[model samples]
Target chain A: MSADAGTDADAGADVGAYADTETGADTDADANTAPDATATAAAAATAPAGTPPDATPWRRLHPLSLLVTAQLLAGAAFGAGVPVGAGLAAHIPFRAAVAWVLAGSALLLAGGLALDVLRLRHTRYRVGAERVELRTGVLFTTRRSLPRDRIRSVDLTAHPLLRLLGLVKVRIGTGDQTAGGESPLQLSPVRRAEGESLRRELLRRAGPAAGGSTEGRLAALVPRWIRYAPLSFLTPLLAMTGWGAVMQVSQWFGAEETVVDLVRDTFSPLPAGWTVLALTLLFLSAGVVGSFGTWAEMWWNYRLEREPDGTLRVRRGLLTTRSISLEEARLRGVDVVEPLGVRLSGAARVDAVATGLSRRDSEENDLSTLLPAAPRAVADEVAARVLRAPVALTRPELAPHPRAALARRLRWSLGAALVPVAVLLLLAAALSVRGLAYAGAATAAVLLPAAALLARDAYRSLGHGLAGPYLVVRSGTLRRSTVALRRDGVVGWTVRQSLFQRRAGLVTLRATTAAGAQAYAAYDVGEAQGLRFAEEAVPELLAPFLVPDDGAVEQPAERTCPDRWSPVRT
Target chain B: MQVVGIDREGRNRGPGPAGLRLRPPHHRVDRRAVAWWRTRLLLAAAVPAGVLAVLGALLGPARFWLLVAGAGVAAAGLAAGLGLPAWYYRVHRWEVTDDAVYVRTGYFWVDSRIAPMSRIQTVDTERGPLQRAFGLAAVTVTTASAKGALRIEALDHEEAAELAEQLALATQKTPGDAT
Candidate 1:
């Protein structure tokens, strides 16, 4: 909510210049106020080189332990829900609704607990000119340290809750994936004034920002900490706002229920409109709660900042404020994770694959996106920019295709809808016009939107431009997506045509990286292009994916030649 | 007519390499393959007869029993003719080297395809209870295409595993340059 800088030199204001590197909140004259946040900072500013430690030079971050307990608890809740949701979905008739609500509530509680854990975890991060060491990881205990020299960028983040806690998480990304996204160190919740000063210090170490940031790689870097809004609220809110009114009206008229009962008795079927509405609310509530619960944990302590040097910094932690900086060149690959619920709103998460450890271990779930529905353009721009290249499609345009709107589409959908009805009529079920109309409702509700979507999706397929050094493939039909490739950046390309596809003269294309293959499968494209892709995309796309299975690779020894497996030709 | 030659390791103990050679795989008639073929042929022949048998069963006191008998014989024949070959393909074994792995099996076709190791990119080891019964395993060496999937049937378990490891190492070392 507020800030301070360079005014108090008595505490160590001489080092004020470093704090000003990012914020543009700096001036030369005031040397006094900058070091007010820490006695160490103030002392460092004033002390001569010969100044020995008045006390111990090392500060122990172990004092903040409670926050970790909360993280462990949240992880436990996540693990528990894995079983509960899957286990409970099959029973109780309203099992889905009950399961979602229970899971959502549990997650919400976990989110609250996680904030406290993060707070305890935040106190351990300490930064120095030589190295920033962040210590976190519950079971697989880890302490990550990045030499300031290796630091590619510095990211500072703060959110409302972090502000409330008077703490922030500082992360220094070293273009490494070995240790998961845990910064070499965290500042844990440090004084707000001190956090910025420290961020500047890191930037000064990282050096000046230059270059008209390359094409295809810049993406919107979100603040690490912010308010967490549970996505569960939307659907429930919609149903309540929309269908809830319908239920309310039906209940008020009471006569509506009588009519329904009379019709149900005559038809001998249960017509429980209220039950249906309630079930809908239940699903929405659970989904929203689980999503919002995590949101609360994430945004409850989120802060994101765009650094002057083209690095997007994020800082977040409910209990332990986490800060991390990602520079343009500090990544090998970028991935978007779309959890099932997030997929409903067409949202995805983003993570950078760095060099050190694989992302599962190095990229802390901390610096990833918290959005429920970021567009494909945003994904493309972010991936391309962060990877330090033009994303082939930074800003994508939407094109609605008419492939499905033609006569064939209508015929097929109509045929699909009519098949059952026609079958019943043939069976002499006496499906009258009224009975046929009952079936027709399904055709309208189920088939119409799907047909519209099919057409819209075909329209949405943006043409791809495979130009640039890498084969930057930009294609998105519905939830628009552009997969950019550097021709030299892939490890290999696999093309396959199923029997049906072969008959249609089509093939599936996949680009494999050490991480895995990018499935451009089932895409309709020219065979010639698919054939050329292996030659063009594999070399560069697959380089990063090649992980030495524990560095045992050695040059093969020469043998006289007899022991070889021959090819199988049928 | 018998043929003799050195075993795979090139030990020259038999008839000094100037011996008669057996006909190539395609020319040889696999007993199992022929027997299976006959069964299928017989089943096809029974189709019209099956209807007659069923009719006879209905009219003649033996009814469903006659139909059942015919079907049972056809089923048994189908199983005998087909089961072994299916098992042969499923329970094959191999020991692939840099140039070729030996293969031997017969259900319908007593045939072996020894692919030179130079062509293989991956070697897979497969086993099952039937394979275990022989204390053996099947080694399959695969390239990047379906035409490249070569299977060698029935190798000693340890030998199969070692050969698979060797083939893997060989391919990894010289895949692009392998002649």
Candidate 2:
């Protein structure tokens, strides 16, 4: 299990490179069965009852999958043995402990391999006319089936080991959010050709392509985009992860204290401030390097293309390559996201706001991403081409929110900044600590201006506008996102006003859609302006409830009207 | 009722002298909703409060503080249980128009949702034990949007059923998958 976990971590860490070898496998699979896959799909669709069951019979995973399982088990045994051997060495002779560890590992490996072989023998899947079914297990068999029409996605992925063996994992998703974290259907370590054929057959649309001009390459990897990798929030997080990993490994080896002592001694000669500064610089540089490698691994050979059948396909990854297919018919909009660091560097990433693009746990493997962080112009261009809009919907100038919005942000920001400072000062007063007082003052000095700056930036980020057939909303400071949602896609409107907002005559309007993020808001706009915007964005939706404000009538007071009535005794 | 005086001809008059304003929805929730809310709140608060009181009585060293905390919780629960239900009843309102379902809810922070009839996917009536005991039911109008489900809580059970039927019929009249 530990060895399996280790390999899983290795596969997850550089999700891109897992499929370098699988590229050849994929192309070969396409070449072999491209036409056959389509023909079979057409036949299945047109004559479900006429086609013989043998034509689409239950298929087992490639025999090489057993080899893959055995190899993983062997690696796991070695991985588990070393730590156990080391622990045993302390209690017994080194040679004797080593022998015991080796024997134990061999026994464990044999047991694991036997179990996998049973699993391999039992597992079988078939693409039937109406449903795709998988049956697997020995004592307790589980048969799961997904209706063909309900199938939303057929993604193909290959980690390094699977890629090396010319196999890919096929995941079929229905976009249904089942409770209890039940995962979508998966067929792991299938021969690349079989996986390709299954994917093509499952995702084939019955109708003609939406537009012939819209099909083809939308975007490809630009090598220089790697420069923006270190400008993401992931860099600092990666640096911390790296530091933690080093500490954890050292502790396992019983050299944690030694390494800590070495570091302390090296920094002991410097002042505390210099030591802190130097450590920060060191960690930041390490993070920058890590980010660059991560970017390359994830975005290398990245390509976005619309298939002739109107399926948007994103194929990328340096090591463990992934191919994700999304039906263009399901796409409601696109989101152009710019994190604080990336925004400063003038780069943004584009994500699809499509129904059924449900992510499967891992944040790194976001299925909605259409383009990784790239030049802002390129991001806009790709977004425009993907939506087939005349110009980038995110380019138009949006209506600025009321000034009261700025006031609200300022109040919130300053209050948040002062809370810790106030706490420190109160502590200083209670404890009579002069140093704490100084620290509180210093904190106030730094945080106040920074908070004010952020408040201003956040206020500036607020804007909403209509572009062609889409309603665009732009907001956020730390991670700015400009979403362009189809006007017709909005299913409902939620208008909210807090006591503070009511006092300021402002409202936050959220446009609810079935696509990405579910609800996007136009935050803290003037009440009248917001109502007008909502009414205009989706004509006639909010018109009936809206009444002209005849100047003679004042806005209703916040307090409930005194017209109490008894409960109806139905 | 406040907005009934306005004529349909006035709708396209655009911005008024001051500005356009959203009129409150037509009907308030059934008055029994207050009792339902109070019962629910008290029921929710009872378990923790009872546990704390029991612990206060049993534990020696921490008895006084635990008892004080229990009393505080009970007091807060009582205050909110008595005061908030009426406030919520006053605020919550719902109306089903020909083209859309308009609902106004929330007490301190008011929220109004308008889901077009064309976009509604399903209409369901839910009756919990307490609600059933009170002869009331809640009507839920679900739109294609995940967050666009509008629940008109604490209506007469028959009224809720009728509303659901009306909404279902209105939705059925429109074409295309709501998404």
Winner by DockQ:
2
Candidate 2 docks with a DockQ of 0.40
Error of 2 at A305 (Å): 1.1
lDDT by residue (tens digit), candidate 1, A459-535: 34423334455443434433344444444334334444444443333334554332212223324333333333343
Relative to the unseen true structure, what is the Cα RMSD of model 2?
A: 9.9
Candidate 1 chain A, run of 10 with poorest lDDT: A29-38
Residue range B1-179, candidate 2, lDDT tens digits: 01232232112223344366788876788888889999999988787789999999999999999988988888889999999999898789877777888889997789999998898888889999999999999999988777888989988888788778867887899887687
For model 1 the interface RMSD, in Å, equals: 21.5
Q: Fraction of true contacts kept, per model?
A: 0.02, 0.58
What lDDT score goes with residue A484 in model 2? Answer: 97
TM-score of chain A of each: 0.48, 0.85
Q: Quantify all predictions' global Cα lDDT against the true fold.
A: 0.44, 0.79
What tens digits encode model 2's per-residue C-alpha lDDT throughout A366-443? Answer: 688999988899999999999999899987888888788899999999999999999999999999999999999999
